[model samples]
Target: MEKKELEYIHSFAEYVDRFIRLLIDYSPKLVSALIILFVGLYVIRFINRLVRKIMVKRELDPTLSKFLADSLLWALRVLLFVTFISKLGIETSSFVAILGAAGLAIGLSLQGSLSNFAGGMLIILFKPFRVGDTIEAQGVVGTVLEIQIFVTKLITGNNQTIFVPNGILSNGVIINYSMQGNRRADLVFSLSYDTNIKTAKDIVMQVMLNHPKVLKNPAPTVTVRDLTDSAIHLSIKPWAKNVDFGDMSSDILENCKEAFDAAGIVTQPFVREASKG
Candidate 1:
């Protein structure tokens, strides 16, 4: 054999030896890392199930409970990842620093979402409103159906669904009709000037008082509000529980119409004047 060929063979053997030694040295670390990963995953699942059970037992608010659970899950996952890396004999400080930097970048990029998350947390903490409450805010009046981390879902009177961002909802003015448990309805009725004011008042007042939903403590009131050229406007104010407000107002109006007609009290609906010929 030539001297060059022998040297080439010797070099190939040296490379193979180094490769085998490397495989032997690193195999245990790799296996340990894999084992740690699988075990960590199982523990995470177990912890998640336990937390869910605790939340159910405590009857915690669904949105807040979900947020807490997810936060815990991600934290555990990050810790597990760090442990897996360290088990593989890799330095963790630089990896941790990299993770921190990446997290900061992601936080900055998702500023709006983070703000919404914070708003949701505040809502859960302070409880300005809750699920199933009827509220009016940002020009939308509806019942709260669901409150999530970033957005809230509302179902309006006409059955239209609305999605309002938590950031806006928390920061803006919220009028929770259900919070106080009662609401006042302001209604106006028109009558011809020729109609007897006392009789008209009695008929409308009777209708409101007879209604089962109207609260007796506040008592319904009927007062002459304005004197127009064509008619007299009577302001009718009734207080009812929030749950009964809609039905009570509708019932009062309908019953008042029937009563007014029966008593010969004429309610004049104003009409727009026609253009002169």
Candidate 2:
């Protein structure tokens, strides 16, 4: 029994020695890997900050810039992970293959979402329209409230809120009305054939020019548009600041009514909302 105990102690001692040797052999590798991980993370954060600063300097859209910075951060971290694994003698090629396969699977499963994400990136990058701009698309005309990564929010003239997915918006045609800074209103007036055409033209022109909001440089024009069996039609074209476009139409129509009544001119004038694309 004493001889067997001695043999057991010897065997335990040998196992301990082997463990010690193994630890010593791997300690340096483990320490280096840890150092790289910590340092790589720090470097990634620093780079992300630098990229964000650059984007700000370039005046990139705020939402788009943040998205780009986060994407770069994840890509860099993935590369650092590959390097970290390679440092520890892991088969990096096999790991990369696994990552690729996983990515492909995920991409397939979320193809619709990916398409929307891609569309969002394009819209933000190209800036076909911006928040606060009045736009017409998807059978809706409204002012843009927010431009987000997945959807754009709009407030319609009737005060209805709308959310449009980036995928459909980017693919469809958009009409931006505010980009021009000014809009033209076409007011049509129909007077009885007996009414003096020259008097009607002068009245409409005076109303458009005397208004404070209308642009004077273009010189408002009143011309005979069409003659029907019931009346003679005249088109009154005036330009005004985009912000005042809707108000301008209402005011012009009201003023024309008062003016014609006072002038003893019998006429009916109607205005159409400015159409733009």
Candidate 3:
């Protein structure tokens, strides 16, 4: 029993000695790896800042600049991490293979998200629309709030926030109302058939000219669009700055009604669709 106990003690001591020797052998490499990691992190941060400054100086779009900076920072950090691990005498080839496999699995699982990311890249590159532009897409009309890697945000006329995936948004038709800086208001008004077409047109034109927001260069047009059984259809089209489009359109409509009433012009209900005989 005594002999057995001595053997166990000797075995324990040998294990401890081996562990200490291993630590002694690896200590410098581990310390060096830690230092490299810290230095790499600092360098990455500095590079990120430098890239951002360069992007700003070049007047690049904010969304694209941020995305590029973040992607670059992450890739550099990953490379630094691999270097650190390799310094510790770990075989990086196997590590990289495992990472590749894992990335493949993750990519397969997140196909939709990857597609959105690609779409975001396309949007940033092509610049179909920018932030703060009023756009109509995916059956929703809204102001562009934010453009993200995976999704784009919009604020509707009713102030509803919508998060649309970039993948779908990129594929669909986007109507950018503010792109041209000016928009035309297409309004139709109906009056009794007895009302003079020329007089009604003159009144509408006068109201449009009086409005400060309406543009005069393009000129406001008021003409007889159609002659219906119940009323005369007049088309009132005016051009205004995109920013003031909604307000100018509403004001023009209200002012036209007031002017018509003052001029003793009668409004009439007309059937939009004619019955088939």
Candidate 4:
């Protein structure tokens, strides 16, 4: 029994010695790896900040800038992790292969999401519209609230929130009404055939030109657009700042009605001619 106990103690000492030697052999490499990881992390953070500053200076879209910074940081950190593991004498080929396989599986499962991400990238690179801009697309007209990777948020005139997929939005036609600082208000008014066309045109033009919100540079125009059996159609076009478009148009329409009524100019409805047998 004493001999067995001595043998067990000797075996335990040998195990401890082997562990000490392994630790000594690996200690320097582990310390160096840790230092490299810390430095790499710091460098990555610095690069991310630098990139963000540059993006801000270049006036890149905020949403896109953040996405790019995060993606770059994650990629660099992943590379750093791989380097740290390799420094510890760990094989990385299999690790990278596993990551690749996992990425492939995720990609396959999120094909639609990937498409939206691509679409978002395209939108950021080539901006068709910006936040706060009024746009018409997907049979909806609304102001852009937020631009994101998967979807864009819009607030309609009726105050409804809509989430539009970036994939469809990027592919479809986007009518940005606020791209131009000024917008033209096209209004059509009909007067009775008995009312002089020239008089009606002059009245509408006077109202448009005298409006405070209408731009005077381009000059508002009121021209005879069509001559119907029961009425004379006049097209009134006035230019105004985009922000004041609604108010300007509404005021002009109301003013025209009041002015026509005061001048005894009657608005008439279109009358179709009877088909001859």
Highest TM-score: which candidate? Answer: 3
lDDT of 3 at 9: 97
- Per-residue lDDT tens digits for candidate 2, residues 158-202, read 999999988999999998989989878887777778888898889
Give one digit per residue, the lDDT tens place, for model 3 in 1-277: 6999999999999999999999999999999999999999999999999999999999999999998999899999899999999999899999999999999999999999999999999988899999999998899999999999899999998889999999999999999998999888888888987788889999999999999999997998988887878878888889999988889988988898889889999986432322211
Off by over 4 Å in 3: 270-277
The TM-scores of all predictions, comma-separated, are 0.86, 0.83, 0.93, 0.87
Ranking by lDDT: 3, 4, 1, 2
Task: Kindly indicate the candidate among 2 and 3 with the higher lDDT.
Answer: 3
> What is candidate 2's CA lDDT for residue 177?
88
lDDT of 1 by residue, 1-277 (tens): 9999999999999999999999999999999999999999999999998998899899998888888999999999989999998999999999989989999999999999999998888988788899999998889999999988889899999999999998989999998999988888888788888889998998888888888999998878989877989898888888899989989888887898788888887888642222212
- Residue pairs with clashing backbones, model 4: none
Q: What C-alpha lDDT do the candidate models reach, one value each?
A: 0.88, 0.88, 0.90, 0.89
- Displacement of residue 252 (Cα, Å) in model 4 is 0.9
Better candidate by TM-score, 1 or 3: 3
List per-candidate RMSD values in Å.
Answer: 5.2, 3.7, 3.4, 4.9
TM-score, candidate number 2? 0.83
- In candidate 4, what are the lDDT values of residues 1-277, reduced to their tens digit? 6999999999999999999999999999999999999999999999999999999999988999999999999999999999999999999999999999999999999999998998888887899999999999999999999999989899998999999999999999998999988888887887888898888888888998889999997789888877877678787888899999999988988898899999999986532222211
Descending-TM-score candidate ranking: 3, 4, 1, 2
